[model samples]
Target chain A: SAVISQKPSRDICQRGTSLTIQCQVDSQVTMMFWYRQQPGQSLTLIATANQGSEATYESGFVIDKFPISRPNLTFSTLTVSNMSPEDSSIYLCSVGRDFTEAFFGQGTRLTVV
Target chain B: QQQVKQSPQSLIVQKGGISIINCAYENTAFDYFPWYQQFPGKGPALLIAIRPDVSEKKEGRFTISFNKSAKQFSLHIMDSQPGDSATYFCAATMGDAGNMLTFGGGTRLMVKP
Candidate 1:
C-alpha cells in the first residue's frame, strides 16, 4: 500500500478557468497515472505520466486539454487547461507498486460553475 | 466503445447480508482484475484484486470472483455494514498493474444497518 497526498481537495471555479492538481507519493514509483471520474460515471483513464518522457494520453483525451508533468518519481501535476463545465470531475493520481498493487490518492474534486 | 459493462447501477443490502457487483469486459487480453471502493469526496481505494490464474480471491470480508472464459468478474462483500456504503468500481487492465485501466460503470452500494 502507498500513501498519496493530493492538493486542493476540492474547488469551484468559473468556467474557462484552469486548475492544476498536484500529487505526491511517499516513495518513488515506476508508473503514475491520471484518471477522471465524472459525476455519477465510471473512472476514465486520462493519461500515463512517466518521468523524463512525454505523457501518453488515451483516445478522446488530448494533452492540450489536460497537461501532465511528472518531474520525479514521487511527484506529478495535472493541469486542466481552459476548463469548461464538461471538465468538472474528480481527478485522481494513482501509483503502481511491485508490479501488482496500485494505490490512489484522495483525489481533487473540480467543479466548474 | 465501452469496453467494460457493469450491472445494477445501484444496490441496497442489509447489514450482515451480502452485496454483489458484476462486471464484464470485451477484451480477452486483460489479465488483471481489481475492485475499487470510493467514498464521497475521496479517491477510489483498492479493495481487492484477482488474477486470471485463480477463480477466486478473498481479503478480509471482501471477495473477488473471476471467470476468464466469460470475460467477467464480480465483487462480493460479506457481512456488509453501513461503513461499506459507497461507490464500487470493477476495473480490468492488460500488461502491468497501473497501466491504462478500463473501468466499469460503477455500482453504488448502500449497506443499510
Candidate 2:
C-alpha cells in the first residue's frame, strides 16, 4: 500500500475561480489517477496522469476542464478549471501499487460558492 | 451508457449482521472488479477485489463474489460494525483501457450499534 496525501483538504472557492489540488505519494508509482465524487454518488475518473505524457480523460471530461500534470512518479496535480456550482464535489487522487490493488488520498472537498 | 450499475442506493444494517451490495457490468471485456470503502472526509480504500478467473475472494470479514457469466459481482461484509458505516463503491476496468475505471453509483451503508 502507498501513503497518499493531498493538500488543501478542504477549500471554498468562488464559482468563477479555479483550484489546483496536489497529490503526493510516499513512493514512486507508475500510474496516478484523479476522480470526482458528486455528493451521494460514485467516484468518476477525471483523468489518468502518466509521467512525461498527456493525461487520458474519460468520457464527459476534458483536459480543458480538468487539466492534470504529472511531473514525476510521486507527484501530480489536478486543476478544476472555471469552476461552477456543479463542480462542487470531493476530488481524490489514487494509484495502483503492488499487483493490481488501488489506494487513494484523503481527498479534497471543494465547495464552489 | 452506464458501464456499471449498483443496486440499493442506501442500506442500514445492524451490528453483527451481514451487509450485501450488488453491482452489474455491461462490458464483457472488463476483467477486474474491485470494491472500496470510504469513510467520511477520507478517500476510499480498497476493501476487496476479484478477477474473472475467480468466483469468490475473501479477506477477513470482507468478501467479493463475482459471476463472470452474469457480469455481476457483490460485496458481503460479515459481522458488520459501526465503523463499517460508510460509502461503498464497485468499479471495473479492462487492462487495455489504460486502467481508466468505470464505477457504479455508490451505496451508502450505515451499521447501527
Candidate 3:
C-alpha cells in the first residue's frame, strides 16, 4: 500500500474564492484520483490524473470547477475554484498502485462560508 | 444514473455481533468490487476487495460475497467491535486502463459495546 499525504486537513473558504489541495505519495505511482464526499453521502469521483497528461474529469464534474495538476508520478493537486456552499465537501486524494487496490490520504474538509 | 446502490444508510450492531451491508451494481462492465472503511475526518480506506470470478473473499473478520448473476455483492463483518465503527462504502470499477470507480451510497455502521 502507498502512503498518501494531503495538506490543509481542512479549510474555510469564502464564497467566490478558491482552495487548492495538495497530495503527495510516498512512492511513485501511475495514476491518482480525486474524489468528493458530501456530508452523509457517497463519494463521487472528480477526476483521474495521470503524470504528464491532463486530468480526466467524470460526468457532472468539469475541469474549470475542479482543476487538477499532475506534475509528476508522486505528486498531484486539486483546486476547487469559485467556492460556494454547495461546493463544501471533503476532498480526497487516492493512489492505486497495483491497479486493484487503492490507498487514500486523510482528506481535506472544506467549508464554504 | 447511479451505477452502484447500497442499502441501509445506517446500521447499529452490538459488539460480537454480525454486521451486514449490501450493494448492487447496474453496470455489467464492472468487474472489480471493493469495500472501503472511513472514519470521521479521514479518507476512505480499502478494507477488502473481490473479483467477479470468485464467489467470496475473506480477510480476518471481513468478508465479501459476490453474485454475478444478480450483479450484487455484500460485506459481512463478524465479531463486530466498537473500533470497527465507521462509514462503509461499496465501489465498482471496470478493471480497465483508467480504473475509474463508481461508488454506492455509504452505510454508517456503529458497533456498540
Choose the strongest candidate by TM-score: 3
Model 2, CA-based lDDT = 0.89
Model 1 iRMS (Å) reads 2.2
Each model's number of backbone clashes? 0, 0, 0
lDDT of 3 by residue, A1-113 (tens): 78999999999999999999999999999999999988888889899999998998888999999999999999999999999999999999988866778888999999999
- By lDDT, the better pick of 1 and 3 is 3
**Candidate 1 residue-wise lDDT, B7-110, digit = tens:** 88999999999999999999887888888889988888889888899999999999899888888899999999999999998888876445567889999999
Q: Which model, 1 or 2, shows the larger DockQ?
A: 1
For candidate 1, the docking band is medium
Which 10 consecutive residues of model 1 chain B have the lowest summed lDDT? Answer: B93-102
Worst 10 residues of 1 chain A by lDDT: A95-104
Indicate which candidate wins on DockQ: 3
Over 4 Å off, model 3 = none
Write down the lDDT that model 1 would get.
0.89
Q: Between candidates 1 and 3, which one is better according to DockQ?
A: 3
In model 1, the runs with Cα more than 4 Å from the true position are none
Please name the candidate that would achieve the greatest lDDT relative to the true structure: 3
Work out the iRMS of candidate 2. Answer: 2.4
